[model samples]
Target: MTVNEPTNHQDLAEAPAATGEVADLLAMLAKQRHFLRFTTRDLTDEQAGLVPTASELCLGGLIKHVASVERGWAAFILEGPSSMPDFTKMTEADFARRADEFKMLPGETLAGVLAEYADVARRTDELVAKLPDLSVSHPLPKAPWFEAGAQWSARRVLMHIVAETAQHAGHADIIRESLDGAKSMG
Candidate 1:
C-alpha cells in the first residue's frame, strides 16, 4: 500500500468481539501500529529520513526498527530460542551491518518500511490467533539486558511487543513534530 493509504485495521475494531487474551493483545498492537503509521502519513522518503533532533532516530528508521523487532519476536515465539541470533557471537562487522536495519539507508523508501511493518503486523496477529496457549513459555534469548535463565510466557511477549511498539510510536511522534510541527495525536 502507498504511504497515504489508510491501514486496514478492521480486525482491531472487531477485536473486542473476539474472545480471549489474543484479541486484547491484537487490539493494543493495532493501536500502536496505527499511531506509528499515522505519524508517517504524507511523508516523503527524504523527509522520513531526516534527523530532526539530536537523537539518531528518524521516522523511517523508527518504522524499520519496529518492523524488524516485531518480526524477530514473532519468530522467537513460533520457533523457540533457536530462532534468536546470538549477538555476542557476531563480529563487529556483523553488528555494523545489522545496525542498518534501524535506519532508512539509501534506496530505502518510507513506503517500503510501512509495507514491511504491515506484513509483520499481519503475521503477528495470525500467530497470536493460532496459539493454543498464551501461557506457553520460552526461554529468553541470552542477552546482557535479560536476567540469566529468564523465560517469558507468550502473553508476556505480546505485552512486551505492545510496550515496544507504543514506545517507538511516541518516539516517531516527537520526531515528526520536530520535522514540521505536525503531531501524531492531539
Candidate 2:
C-alpha cells in the first residue's frame, strides 16, 4: 500500500467527532480560548485594559497572559525544559517583563492582543496534532511551583494549557462582569 492510502476499511471510515486524545485536548483548549476571548467582545482598548476590580487583572491582559503561557508550554513540549527559563535565576527585569504581559500598554490595541492570541492558539493546535507521541515527556525546569526533579508528558502539558485557559477565562468573566455586568456563562 502507498503511504497516503489506508490499508484497511476501518481506516477509510469517517472519523469520530474527536477521534483521539490529542483531538480531545485540542477541543477543550479551543472551548476555553473562546470563553476567554468572548469576554472582550464590544470592548474598547480602554475598557479592555481597565482594572475594573480590586485586583490588577484586565480582560486584554488576561488574554495576553494566557496566550504567552500557552506559547511557552507548547514550545516546552517540542524543545523540552530548555524552552523555558530557569525560574531560580529570574532577574527583576524578567519579572517586570512578565508583569508587562498582563497590561495593554499605551498604543496597544485590544484587537492586536486578540490577534496575537489567535495566532498562538493556531500554532499550539498544529503542534499538538503533529506531535508523534503524547506520552513523550521531559524533566521540568527548576521552578518554585514545580516539584523538584519532576517530569511531565506532552499530554500533561496540554492539560495544563487547558487548565490555565479555563482559569483565566473565569478571571476574565469576573473582570468583564465588574466592568459592565456581562457574564460569559450567565
Candidate 3:
C-alpha cells in the first residue's frame, strides 16, 4: 500500500508518526532476511541442489534468484533510470559454468548468497535512513505485481522490498524443509 504524505508542517513535525511508515518496512526486511538465513542453514550440496520436481527451482537456486533480485531492486532504488539485470544473458549451461556456481563464485553457495544479501540489506537500510522526504517519488517498474500509473515513495519501495523478500523467505523455508528434515522455520 502507498503511504501518502501529511499535508502540513504540524503533521510533519510529529516524530513518532513519521517513523511508523518507514521503520516498519526496514524491520520487515531485516526479519525476512533473518528467517531466510535460518532456513538455509546446515544443508548438503546435494540437498540444496535437489528440486523435488521438474520445476527448475531448487533451494539453492531460490537463494541465487533472490540475491539477484535484491541487487536488481537495490540498483533500481539507487539509480531509477536504469533497467534491472537481464537474466536471459545467462543460460542454464552458462550458470553451470560460472565459477561462483562451483561455490568459488561470489553468489553461488547458500551461505555466500545470504552473506551478499546481508550486504545488500545494509545498503538498502542506509538508503532508507537517508531518504530526504517520505513523499519522494520513484518510478515503479512495469510488472504484473504492481498497479500501473502508480507513483511510489522511498517508503513504499522499502516496504515493497520487505514484502517481496518476506514472501520469498517463506518459500525458502518450505523448500529447505523439503530438502531435509530440518523443520525449525515452521
Q: Compared to the true structure, candidate 1 yields what TM-score?
A: 0.90
Better of 1 and 3 by lDDT: 1
lDDT per residue as tens, model 3, 121-186: 666667666676656776666555556756676666666677767877777667766676665433
Off by over 4 Å in 1: 1-17
In model 3, where do residues sit more than 4 Å from their true spots? 1-20, 83-107, 142-147
Residue range 1-186, candidate 2, lDDT tens digits: 211221211111222244478778887887777778877877888999999899999988998899899999999999999999999999999999999989999988887888788778878887788788999999999999999999999999999999999999999989999999977774
- In candidate 1, residue 161 scores what lDDT? 90
**Root-mean-square deviation per candidate:** 4.0, 9.9, 10.6
> For candidate 1, what is the total of clashing residue pairs?
0
1-186: candidate 1 lDDT, tens digit per residue: 323424532222223234566777888788888888888877889998999899988888888888888888888888877898886687888888677866899999888788777777887888888888988888988878888899988888889999999999999999999999988766
lDDT score, candidate 2, position 169 = 90
Error of 2 at 51 (Å): 0.3
Query: CA lDDT of each candidate?
Result: 0.81, 0.84, 0.58
- Model 2: which residue pairs collide? none
